[model samples]
Target chain A: MEKIIVCIKGVPKPGSIKVDPETHTLKRENMELILNPNDRPALEMALRLKNTYNTEVVVISMGPPNVIPLLKYIYALGADQIILLSDRAFAGSDTLATSYVLAKAIEKLSPFSLVLMGLKSIDGETAQVPPETASLLGIPSLTNVKDLFMERGKWIAIREMDYGEEEIEVTPPIVASVSPLAFDYIRPPSLKRLLEVKTKEPLICQVKDLNLDPQRLGLQGSPTQVIEVFEKKIETKGLVLEGSPEELVEKLIEILKDKGLIKF
Target chain B: MFEKIKLEDLSKENILAYGEFYKGELNSSSLEILSPLKEIAQTLNKKLILVSLIGSLENIKDWEEIKKSLADEVWFVINEELKDFREDLYTEVLVKIVKFSQPYGFFFPATKIGMSLAPRVAGALQVGLCAHVNNLEVKDNQIIMARPTYGENIIAKLISKSIPIMATISLGAFGIKYGEKEPSIKEIIFPEDFVWKSKLKIRRFAPSKKKPTKLSTAKVIVAGGRGLKNKETFQKLFELANLLGAEVGATRPVCYEGWVEEERMIGISGVTVRPKVYIGFGISGALQHTVGMENSEFIIAVNTDKEAPLVKIANLALIGDAGKILELLLKNLSK
Candidate 1:
């Protein structure tokens, strides 16, 4: 049977983000952590592939020990098995370092026919890790994939390229960064699956267990360092106008013109 | 103190190109990189080098002239099969040159072809690579690169810990400028018998032709959000944009709702714009959406919410109905 691996990230839940006024760091206390929104599309895609082709879907994530709750959630999504790569050494990693660790873990999990991931994580928004990860593994990869299917042991994908859409056909051992649009057609998780997931335990892995190169798996291995993080000060104050629609628009146009936004 | 250099100074730095002109003249993205290379070279007082894989030295006369307009030295590698961009061939040729010359820094446009070649080069060299940089500067004998994060909401500064720092600049970040003085150019020839491997096959080569909306370079831009309600109201926003000779943009929600296409969205998931003038109609200025266009020279926000975030950053904040304001703007512009 074909095997597939789906990489997921547990991030701070949306609509619950609170920033510390002083440090500008995200407040973790009382904030719920869940799988990244984009990862749902990846999970759904994996599940569809597994069900259609009688394949095994393995979900993997790297985060703190507190991220276990999210691993359970992935199991609830019909993933056959899950692994969590939790280690303090993996903290404060940028995309490059993160991709390094993930690629190493993928090597350990090799022999799988396909690998899947979300196009980006909402928290980081770098959108570079998946492609970088594929490069490290030396595999053909497609990004921003809106649709995917398998026919006669080959994978067909519709990818969003810089200039237009591209339909590519690649044999197995391919990586794909799926777009959120792919999940719009998925049905909600069934109750039986949720209950089964809650009663199950995920296989956990640590950096030590993976035997990865210490110099390339964490903060110490990272070549790029963040020098500073600060909020940008707003420089322009807004112009407030309260009047009839016709009057307000007339004033707006004049303002735009004076600013050279509109010549006439 | 941060010192700035003029574009003309780039003629002193070494500029190098790899591979032949498969698709005609150097890619536009390459030209964009040359703009900053010229400026950065002047600041560091380095020589420019250009490396080519195919065609005779005379065939690249125009490229040499453009480079001579700014570059100091050019290296040409003549190989019949090296005309097109191939990962294995390009990587092999580039790695050898980069190892031999040991340039202080390297820059590539963040195009698909460039993206494919950059990481491989970095990996082969055993160095770190920074991608999608918006700004690059030299300070205290180190290259400081700035890249947008959090969907352009935040700018992250990074420096290479390893030698020969490499980065790929986002396409729209650097602006092209002409230098005043004609540059001095010299050519170097590479010996034959370059080693190459062919592991990947080119099943097909078709252009996607997906053009990024030149929102970042627009002189003026008109944006809308959830408040625009429906396609009809969004149409009014476009009308105003047309009258102002500006491009039309939308918020994330509006784009997600399919009220407008994704290319028209502005904010973290959308394009980062620094237009001369920006008009926000019925937009709440969510942090994700605001960062993309916040750098505009002037901002005008029209929304019923007086305390909306859009109002806070706008130079002119009009507190009124977005639909009504759009209608009035269209009427006045028509007059």
Candidate 2:
């Protein structure tokens, strides 16, 4: 059967992840991890395609060993196969290095017709991985994809651009990054599927499993290094005006006029 | 055939900026990077070359702006094959050009095309790229890039270990100014053996029927949040914006609520706008939403909660009902 690969990430629940006030660094440990909000649409799209086209939906994640539960949870959501790529060697990989590892994993699962992913992770929010990975795999990437369909066995995707929308027709072995704006509802977990997945485990892969160059696996492979990270504090002219809505509106109008924003 | 420059012989000294010339007009943001890049180039004693790939040479109408950009040189790869952007082919040609030019750094505007194209070129070259860079500094001959991460709550300073420190500059991060200079021009011809076809093809593109949002370029912005309640209440913000001749923006929640198009969402996940004046209605000022508009010259926020985070930083914080305030503001402005 033809296969579609959906790359997902387990991220901290929104507003649950906290930053260290003193060090200005993220405190990622011991936090609740949920499927990345952005990845929901990607998984949903893959599952829909699976239902419609009879394609196999293979979901892959790259994170720590703790990511297994998330993978198991995804399986309950209708993924045929779940794979976890976890290793100390994979730690601290930036977008490029991370995409390299993902591309390698995708290559290992060869003959797959499509690769799908979220345009940006909630934590990182750098919509770079999909394109970078596609480049490494020597395939075309359509990112921020709002809509996609198969026409006569050809892939047609409508992507959201800064200016407008673009419709593209692409060949197979292509990667697409789904936009969060595309799909709002991710199917809830089915009780029967969840119970079935309790006994199912993800196929785990470490550095030794994949034929990866040690020099290109983790921090050592990363080209950009974060020298410092700090909390951004904004200082503005604090002025509070409290009164009736009409009074406040009148004050604002006067201010706009003073600033030459409004003409008489 | 273009002469091949070997990687080993590359000096990696000059600075290069990607000049986005699409259709007939040069992107203003591409020119904006030149102001800061000019200073860096002067300090490093390196030539500042504006590199561009164009579909046709005769269609170029922004040559006057290029001439006054203070760039030391111009490099153009003019070909009919480039008429439509093909990611693979463009990445291949750009990788070849970077290999030949051997620049110490390359800057691209953080735009739709740049965001997509820059990473692919960086991937092909196996170089590090800092995305959405807010600022840059040259320290000890290394380009240090600063960018926001973690939902715009934290700013990270980074340095690239690889040559040709590539970065996509954030929109409106740098302002543009003209300097009189006659830059030498060079045209590049692709190698004879480089004839290649891309697997990706454009079926069609229907430009937005609505007027281009142009939020990034708007001098004034009137934004709304969930505090405005349902769609009907939110619609009043547009009337207020129209009277003020300002663009409309939204917080993530409001956008998710389907009050506005995703493009109008101003926050970490959406567009970052730094307008001359910004007014927010019913916004409680989450960091995710505030980061995108914090750089505005002046801010007026109308929220019921006086202690809201955005209220504390606003130039004028009006504590009142969001819907009521919006209604009143619209009535006053439309008069």
Candidate 3:
């Protein structure tokens, strides 16, 4: 089957993030996990390709047991298959280690023609795993892909550059990262379809099953470390204005004029 | 526990600085690395080298002054195909160079281009890297880099046990300035037999005619956020911006919603701006957006909700409808 595999992460929702002062580590106690906001675009893009072609879309993730429901939600969203890379050994894997494990799992699911991922995860905010997985798998990769389509058996992706966008083509068994801002936000699948697939279990791939080296699995294998974290002082409040819109604007203009920002 | 190893075997080469450029001219953010890196190079007693990939080869005329005054030695890898950025090409070429240099320290600008490529290279080498660091210090042969996190609510001090420590520094954190002394130069040829035999192809190249809002260099900026609502209302930001002779900037969601151009977005993922005067209309000051603009000299945020994060940061937190306030301000200013 012509298939595309998407790498997804289940990240804790933004705003409730709290760090432990004593350990200098992220405090996940009572935190609600959600599908990473950034990865939705890539999933949406992959689903679009599936609708247009004779292809199967697969959603793959490496997270705790909680990630299974998320993969099922993706399955409900038109994914043909769900694969979860979950194991105690996979805990504390940084971007490099995470990509290594992901590349191995992807290899296990062979005959895949394309790989799609979001630009970065909200929690770690590293944005490294997608490209790193592409490199480890020895495939040509494109980052910041805003627009994509299949033409003449090649994948055409418009990548966002510093000043503008550039269009490029890559042969399959290649990787492309979707920009969160580039495409239209994903629409919800029908309620009936979502409920039907929410209970299906994803195929779980353990550490040993992937044939990865034990020496390169988790925290010990990662090279960089966060020595400490500090609560930074926010800048003090500026000026507070309470009045009608006209009065507020007038006060603003007065302040600007006082600062020589307005002449006359 | 991890420190009980021989440090002598580590790759202790010069500090490697990535040279970011647009067209043929160097980006202003590129110069931010030179001075801080020079200090670290001295502390480590290693040289500071520039690893530049020139998409279009020209005489050192454009970069001569920077080379002479800031860097110890300059290394350029020229590939005419590099006139535009291709991730496969840039990553492949940079991987080869990193293998050659084995840098003790490496710095990248915290822009979209740099953020995208740096992680890929670090992943290729299987090392650790800190992203968007605003401050850095080197003491006793260890690099301590401070990076903001959790919406700028916390600052994380990072250390890389990896031999070649890598980080992408924030733009305004290390302001670009000129230096005086002339430095030396060298060139490394792009690797042969390294193209991987037509792995990827450029089907088409359509450059975005849109330029970065020039918010960083502007003296005055009038930024709008989601509160402005639709594209038609967002256009009012331009009207106010023009009236004040200011540049236009927007929150990330505004750009993501297509109300404003993506290039005009200001946030951790977009542009970092520190204009003399920044006026926000209907902005909620999410950490993502505020991180990119907190350095502004004077901040004026307009919001109907007085408790919004932007209100806390603004020198003038105007409690009102952003659209209404902007309309009145525009009308009164013209009179």
TM-score of each: 0.82, 0.92, 0.91
- List the lowest-lDDT window of 10 residues for candidate 1 chain A: A20-29
Candidates 1 onward: DockQ, in order: 0.42, 0.68, 0.63
Q: Which of the predicted structures, 1 or 3, would earn the higher lDDT when compared with the native?
A: 3
Name model 3 segments beyond 4 Å from true: A20-23, A27-30, A235-237, B1-12, B59-61, B81-84, B189-198, B227-232, B304-309
Tens digit of lDDT per residue, candidate 1, span A33-139?
Answer: 77787888888888888988899999989887667788887777688888988786786666677877788888898788888998778776656667667767877
Model 2 residue runs over 4 Å out of place are A18-27, A260-264, B1-12, B267-269, B332-335
- Which window of ten consecutive residues has the lowest lDDT sum in model 3 chain A? A22-31
Model 2 CA lDDT for position A5: 98
Best by DockQ: 2
Local error of candidate 3 at residue B27 (angstroms)? 2.8
Most TM-score-accurate candidate: 2
lDDT per residue as tens, model 3, B126-166: 78877777667886779898766755456678788886898
Q: What would you estimate as the lDDT of candidate 1? A: 0.69
The per-prediction CA RMSD against the true structure, in angstroms, equals: 5.8, 2.9, 5.0
Top candidate when judged by lDDT against the true structure: 2
Docking class of 3: medium
Q: How much is the lDDT of residue B211 in candidate 2?
A: 84
Judged by DockQ cut-offs, the docking class of candidate 1 is acceptable
